[model samples]
Structures are given as structure tokens and as C-alpha cells.
Target: MTTPRLTPHAYVLAVPDLTRTTAYFEHVLGFSRLWNDGDNWQALGRDGVRVMLGRCPDAIPPAELGDHSYFAYVEVSDLDGFHAEIAAKGALLGFPPRDQPWGRREMAVATPDGHRMMFANPIRA
Candidate 1:
């Protein structure tokens, strides 16, 4: 029998933020600062995956460039506890966490740059 080949990487996101977005990831999400390209680009993460922030032009319009844009998915060991932690930290949560039919419990929050950050956990039997 032959084994099937699989893609190696699953990159999460490359979000855009003008200000305070990097702080939110470091302070709120507990990700460590990797590096910033200075002036316009910043990177942060704990694991191998890193979230890069790119600065938009001074007058660039809104980020309405279809759904192909970046969306961040953050996994938590304890969904309920994580949710509470976010609330306690005064994060502007978009909606309460809810279990989806796809066997995952999740919630979404918007970043300072309008990027959607999703907090999710797999539903166990």
C-alpha cells in the first residue's frame, strides 16, 4: 500500500493594524514579541507560527477585499475559562462563545484593524 502525501504547513494569519494591535496580542493573548520590521511591520507569537502586522497606506480605504483576507483562529485548552479571562481583561468581545454544529466551540473578536480573531476549542465526546 502507498501512503498519501500531505501538505506540511498550515499558516494562520497575517493581520493588519495601525496601532495597539501588537500590544493586544502580547498583553491579552499572551503571545511573545518576535520582531518588528520597524515603522510598518511587526511580528509576535509563542509557537512556530507568528502573526505579522502590516501597516496600511496613510489613506488606504477599508479592508473590504473579499473574504480571502486573513482570519485568525486561536486555540484554547479551556474554552470557558479563556472566555472569562478575556472578559476580565476588558477585551471588546464581539459575541459570547457558542458551540457550533461542526463540533467546535468558538467566539470571535475584532482587532483594532478590523481583523477577526476566533477563539475555539474542539468538542470532545
Candidate 2:
């Protein structure tokens, strides 16, 4: 038997406003629609990242989760270049890209709902 290798397929989110959240991801993060089911569900992707949204109008907004609302730390290359690209697209990032002591270069972006995604790349010597 072989050990299984794992990779992230998507991150699921419960959102109170699906349309607004979807638009933020598309317009700000440069993701494109992968699939959608009118008002109930949607999937968006960019590069190799995929995010799935489920409409949950009665659920507590992600903003209410505080530290528990962090979305994901996506792996990406060209950390600074990606920062410039998304920032120009009007991404409301929480922090600029910086070299981390953990040997990665990283940045962060947040949705109006207050959920956050961190993007990182391994630092090479």
C-alpha cells in the first residue's frame, strides 16, 4: 500500500450574502466562476486555488468569529508580484508581503465579511 498524498481542493464558507462575497472574490481576488447554483452555492478559482461558498443568510457572519474566521493560507509563487497584481485589482489586504522567519514570504487579504486568507511562498536562500 502507498501513503496518500494530500492537496487542498477548496475551502468552504458559510456566508450571509452570497452575491456580495462572490463579487469580492471575483473582482478583488481575480478569481473566476467555476460553477454556481443560482442563490444557494458557488465555486470560484484562480491560478490553482478554489473557494466554495454556501449561502447561509441566517448564520452568524464570519466577522463574528474573531480569530476563528481565518480562511486559508494559500501557497503561491512570486509572492511580491502577486501582491502587486491583486493590490492593483483593489484587494483590501490586511498586511503587505514580508519575509517570515518560518522561511516563507507572505501576505494577507480579507473579505468584507472579515474572513481572511493568507498567501505565502517558500523563501529561498
Error of 2 at 11 (Å): 0.6
CA displacement after TM-score superposition, residue 87 of candidate 2 (Å): 1.0
Query: How would you encode candidate 1's per-residue C-alpha lDDT over 1-125 as one tens digit per residue?
Result: 98998742333334445357778867776667777777687777755546776766553333464343336677878888987876787676777789999999998766555566688899878
- For model 2, the stretches where C-alpha displacement exceeds 4 angstroms are none
The digit string of per-residue lDDT tens for model 2 on 23-73 reads 999988889999999899999999888999999999988888988889798
Itemize residue pairs with steric clashes in candidate 1. none
**RMSD of candidates 1 onward, in order:** 3.6, 1.2
Candidate 2 residue 98 Cα shift, in angstroms, is: 0.8
Clash pairs, model 2 backbone? none
Q: Which TM-score value belongs to model 2?
A: 0.93
* Every model's TM-score: 0.71, 0.93
